[model samples]
Target: MALLDYWVLAAYMLGIVLIGVFYAKRNRSAQDMFAAGGQAPWWVSGLSGFMTMFSAGTFVVWGGIAYKYGMVAVSINLCYGIAALAAGYFVAGRWKTMGVDTPAEYIELRFGKSVVQLYTWAMLVYRIVGTGVALYALSIILVALMPLPEGNPFRDPNTGNLAVEWAILAFGLVVIIYTMAGGLWAVLMTDVLQFIVLNLSVLFVLVFMLQAIGGVGTFIEQAPAQFFAPVSEGYSLYFLMGWVCIHFFMVGADWAFAQRFISVPSAKEARKSAYLFGILYLVSPLVWLMPPMLYRVIDPSADPEQAYIAACLSVLPAGLVGLLIAAMFSATASLASSQLNVFAGVFTENFYRPLMERRGGSGNLVTVGRWITLLIGLLLIAVAISIPYLGGAEKVIVSVTSLMVGPLFAPTVWGIFSRRLSARAVWSCVLLTFAIGGAFKWLLSLPADGSISPSTLAWLTKHSAVIELGIGILVPLSVLALFTFVIDRNGTPGWIPDRSKNATSNAGAMASDLPARVVAVAMGLCALLLMLIALISHERQLEIGLFALVTSGISAAIYLLGTRTKIAPEFQRAL
Candidate 1:
């Protein structure tokens, strides 16, 4: 049965790659490859952005986090949603207008080529390492889901462990081939399909868990109060600081999420996407978490990875487990495909393309990007194989990403909002954020091995990641503000002039005719209402069925109208 599941996964992955190859012809120009001609509908781009950010690891890892840490995990997710909204409202216009192929290009525009070069290197390092970690998690999930038969050649000879590494390697190779062939067009288009598969899988599993656990009442009865609490475990000042750091990371440095700005047809659509995603993203996590929660109810001592697989397998009927695991693999592919594509984009636009342009032939930029994808994929496979040996894979992954986010977000935000700030200020802020944020995060590490003193843990239980993210955002902004004020007491100089011009030209700024403020307010209100529902549902303050109905109704109405208003143009064009 498990082998059958693995075979199905391989077949499904191959089908996705073939689709990419078929669409490669449509991506003739670099613009088409990079931004899908900025033609994708608001909902498509919006959902893709949401789904891409909803990496497969989010469910498995976050579910585990929720199982272990309780509401703190949800707090972190809420922080991410806010970060996404902030980006949509404020920063995305400049990015969309710049018409740049990659985020590192923004660095070049704001500062000098040297700063751009430095940022490019930094981004490559951060993304590649992060991708490796993501790949490792994906592989671990697969190994857990589809166990290889004993004495099979696919099992490692030395330890008799299943060689999921090879399966992961094959999956990576297929993704790289398709991504390199089709670029962003293929990536975004396939992302649409992948998103559907993932969401259906999520919905299916959630329904199964709810039913198997004897509905919401039984599930809640079996679980601890903290299991449903989103703000309990992360309520401390220190943890609050951590949440701030995390928020900055998501809002600022996450080029993976930020890249959506370039894919949308206009800024109106971008914000619409953000608003829609804020709600859609809320439900997406439940797919991965609910099952684990159900599993934990069954076997309290089951490790997180084990619990995730077990819940998925047990809740899903026998034949469906294979299809569901393949769906999980599709989720993995969706994530890996995007990351590898972005890494390639960054390398080509920031590093190889420039170097090749200076020297002569730019033809090989694509070739080099393909090679980079292949190399990154292999390194990730190595990382995946070694995750089992790591003392604390999850903590290490989260901490490393958290520490690196400060440098990325600080300079980008400073450059965008404050035009007069000199390149020197930008450089200074980057160094300072790296130093301060990194130091603060390391020094105030949260129970390095997930163990905290009861009082300290109790404090964390009350505060959460949002509060930590607040500190992270404030500290960097404070540093930037201090330097900006001192350097140019009058205010930011070159930033505003360029920004004004960019805003006028950028597609996102074309919303000048709409009731911008009204729409913005409406979006905010809807987001707030949904968030309240999420929190209320968590606390079980209202009837579960009623709350779900209200939440779904509001979400559906907003999405339908928002789709017509913001997405219809692109849809018409595509048709």
Candidate 2:
């Protein structure tokens, strides 16, 4: 890396720390610490949602998947966008309407304290592991980007990379400082900035890669046929079906993303945020995956996961490489900070506050929240350091998270949407699914080193886990639905809204006007134009850059116009 690159990265790290410090004064209480005092602008929340979902994994692992597996990877990812849109249209409004600081509080309101407590502990563990894996993934990229001596102590081989371990600690400390300082307010602001940098950096790589490969037509002609297929050789129909189901449930109930819904000013703004997230999802994959896909055409034998780094080194100038690296780091930090804040909220609001109330302790809740944030950040660093020893960071992270959260999906979704399903029935379903899912994951994890028959092993390897996940979700939901029917025959279902907490009124409530409508239409057309130009244009570099600029400009204009409208009192307070 060049000296200029180092300077750029240093500046970004410093800037993020300052942003966190800048927002520190805003967190006067636990409520503000956790949910931005429930007055965040819709666009801020929307961008944060996008950044949280588009983690380091999207830049590295998903790019690798696209490089190796072809367009099927793209198809699979679109499931997330589809799920987000569905949630925006249906589930987001309800979450905002509930007006809770944490998903656990909402769970408590719907069920009871005991269930919420259990769910909180479970989610805490899940997020700690998840954030640790994200940090570990980012460390891998940083290790690749940085210059280390050949015999440096941080380059161990036998028990995973020591450089990765050091990188994790360094990145974790930075994330902890800011996240512990500003809470969710800092997270949203930094996320908006990070989203812009990462998206632009990705576009930079895409344009350069297209230029290097001659053009889009040349890329197509040189790439393997499988790279263009929607359903390639290794990906089975059952896997795709299962992937879609898991994503829908995951997005609908994701705690980190749901925090964005809770932070927005109103149910209507929450819904708008979701729609905005969906629009970004539609366009981002093209820019994110194209460089890696093109890299495969150039060097078919290269590591797919490392394609992004290789392209950066090959195509970008000195300072921009550092900028791209910073963008990657920013992606991971944004996610880790969000996770840390959410974990702090769940632990402080759901767990610690209740304990204090029981004992009649007069502890300052904001102070307690900050302490918990630091604690979670430390735990995440420890988990990240330990992840290297687990082998194959990507695979382990994905398998463990999927196994742990698969069971929670059905109960969470049903609990939110269905009036007939009782809390007791949901609890019963959760336990049953946990047991069965655990056993199924164990079975799938069993050694396949030719101990089993070839055909049976192939089938088991390809389909069992996805099929298991499908079963994990479906069987529990079916049982709950049936139980609800049997118990509530001819009587009103147990879907009564809790009347104790007041819901916030809709903010900036107005019918869409000419400029707003035009901007929306123009945004869609710009996205389509980007896709069309990338597909057909011979001057790939110039056209791709133009598309990126136009898309970004239009998006900025839309945001500025939205800000100029008659502002609600709640939104004004947030500002």
Candidate 3:
């Protein structure tokens, strides 16, 4: 990288820190630190949600998949939009209506403190591993794209080069500092900026790549046969279906995404934010995957995961290359920051605060939260460094997350929707799923060349994580349903508390604010402008134009209706 490139990257990193420092004073309490004081505009929360979900893995693993497998990769990713829409319709509003600061708090409210503690511990582990994997993936890309200085001794003797480890530690520290300083407010605000930068970088790369590849027609002509196939030998229709199911459960139940729902200003805004997230999922993939897909045709035998970085280095100018690198870093940082914030919330709210008898003042709680955030960041750095010992970063990440979260999904969903499911039943189901899924995952992780039987090895190897995820969901739900019928025959009468009365009182005291409405309108206009740019530059004019028009119209309507109407009493009570 050039000196100018370094300067651009440094400026980007500094800018993120400044944003966090600017928001630091606003987080005067635990709620503000964890949930942005529940004052985030719908659009800000929506953009954050989108960025949180769009981790660095999108550019690395998913881009690689697109490079190698073609449209099938895109087809699978579209499941994200489906999941977002489902959450908007079914989960987001309810989460906001409950008015809890963290998902663990909501879980505790519905179930009990024991279950809440269990969930928090599980999430702490999951977030550490998940964030570490993201950091590791981005670090690998950075190491490949940005050369190290001469005679640098950072390289590990055993690993050949420890550039990945150094990169992880360096960037991870930056993320930790900013996240600890500003909390959720900083995360959301910086996410908005990162989203803009990353999308622009994607557009920039896509334009240059298409030109380099001799336009869309030549690019398509040079693509392999499977480039157009939605499903094939390894990735079958069953895999796609399983992937869709996993995403639906994961998106709806995952605490990181749920945090966004709870942090939005109102239940209505939560739902609207989800809709906006879905819109981004629908539109952004076109640009995100294009360069990598084109790179497949350019160098069929290259490491597929490096396609995006390779494209950037090959096509972009020096300063722009740095910007692209910053964008990649932004993806990693946004995701890591969100996870760190959520981790702090879970540890402090569900475990520390309650166990200590709520002894601390708000400032003390926030201080503790910041400390926990810093600790989690350090743990993630260690995890990232250790990732080189793991065979495949992407595979390990997917498998571990699926194994951990798969069991939690059914219980979380049922707990929210079904009064018939007793706490005992939920606990039993969770324990059973953990035992079974963990064993299955462990077996799957074992070396195929070992003493295991051929048939067993084949079953484990052929099924993939998606299929295991399906089993994880199905078995737990099945067990829970059976227990619900036999053990809780009468159901837990009035299982849901009468929060309505309290909610109504809270609602009466608060009024719908106008700033959120204005932000929503502004966001809609930005989306329309993005779509207009797409319509003019890309081949799919009709599709892009329609998307822009619809987004603009809906945004305008939302603003008009928001200004005229009062906040729903139930939603206000939730606040």
Candidate 4:
């Protein structure tokens, strides 16, 4: 990266930290810090959830797959959309309808405190490692961009970039700082910022890439026959179907996503938020994933993992490349911060608050929450630095999310509807399912090394993703079904709420407009920065200026649209 790019990247990071600091003052209590105090509009919560689902995995892992395996990468991502849409329809409104402040609260309510404790610790460990894998992915991109001299102490000879350890340390610290400072409100606003930046930046990448490749139709005509196939060995049609089910359990019951569902005012708003998230995912993947696929044509020998960013660095002018990298940071930061906030909330509400002999004020508990956030952040950093030794980011991500989601979350999701599922049965079924899945996915699979003869079970090894997923989804639910039907079935359904009341928000008119106006001004500033750089350099001035003009136009449109939603002055005064 050029000196200008470094400056741009630094400014973006600093801006993110400042956003956390800005939101910090508004967080007077743990509820405000962790729950948005239920003031977030549906769109804000929805956009935040959408951005939280992104990280460097979207680029490095899926983009690499796109470069190598054709359309399968997009297919894998589309699974998230399909799953989220299902979540919107089946479970998003139910979260609000249950009237729970936190998913853990619901867990404790239905299954008792022991189950909540078990679920909390288990998921905290699970999600922290997942976040670590994401940070590891981002570190790969960063280390690639910042190359080092051969003899430099931090230099990595293999890639001639900074060492992964140092990259992980530096990036992890930045995420931790912002998460500790900003809390969940900061997470929501920054996510919205990332949503805009990522979309606008990728559109620019698509434009440039298409221009370079002549056209989509021309590229398609000249491409290999298999370039557009939607299935591959590891990502077959069965895997995709199973993938949808895994994410359904994930989005519907996972604390981070469920937090988004309950952060809104009403059940209707919660469903609306999830629908918007699903809709965005449905449309955005093809556009965003195209750069890497097109890059496969541009340079077939290019390293697949770096293909997405490489396409941008190769095609985009300097300032915009920096902007795109910053946008990538926004993606990783959004996910990391959201996870941190959710985990902190779980610790505070489920464990720390309950155990206190004399409960401090909510503000004091908020301080305790910050401390817990720091502790988890430290562990996440430790895990990220160790990711290379643990068989790389891709393996860890696929193995964990696929092999564990069903066994861990399915029972929890089912408990929302079934009263016959006792705590003992839940534990028995989840642990038993894990043992079965571990055997299928890990213990019984061919060893990672050139191990016990390749011909022993090549087909089983080839299709392990689908197998693990099938067991993960089917095992726990099947056991639970048996327990409910064949074993015991004589209780009222657990405290199910029949209807959700419309909530009167404590936030007045100005507060209602906060998210939109903040996002608009952020967009305008980013646009101004791009135009200024293009003006100073006088290279690709037209493209950059036009991009800026369109971006600023969107900014104005959002701000004006926000004005329409503000309550009339008298109404605000009445409140």
**Candidate number of the best lDDT:** 4
Model 4 RMSD in Å is 3.1
Which structure is stronger by lDDT: 2 or 4?
Answer: 4
lDDT of 2 by residue, 173-276 (tens): 99899988888988887787787668767877787878788989999899887777777644556656666666666666778888888887677788988888
The model with the greater lDDT, 1 or 4, is: 4
TM-score of model 1 vs. true structure: 0.78
lDDT of the candidates, in the order given: 0.60, 0.73, 0.75, 0.81
lDDT of 4 by residue, 361-438 (tens): 333777888898898888888988877677655655776787688877887888877777888767877788778877
Give the 10-residue window scoring lowest on summed lDDT in candidate 4.
502-511
TM-score versus the correct structure, for each prediction = 0.78, 0.85, 0.85, 0.93
True-structure lDDT of candidate 1: 0.60
Kindly provide the TM-score of model 4 when superposed on the true structure, using C-alpha atoms: 0.93
| Model 3, global lDDT | 0.75
Clashes of 3: 0
Model 3 pairs in collision? none
**CA lDDT, candidate 2, residue 231:** 74
- Listed per model in order, the count of residue pairs whose N, CA or C atoms clash below 3 Å is 27, 0, 0, 0
Q: Which one wins by TM-score: 1 or 2?
A: 2
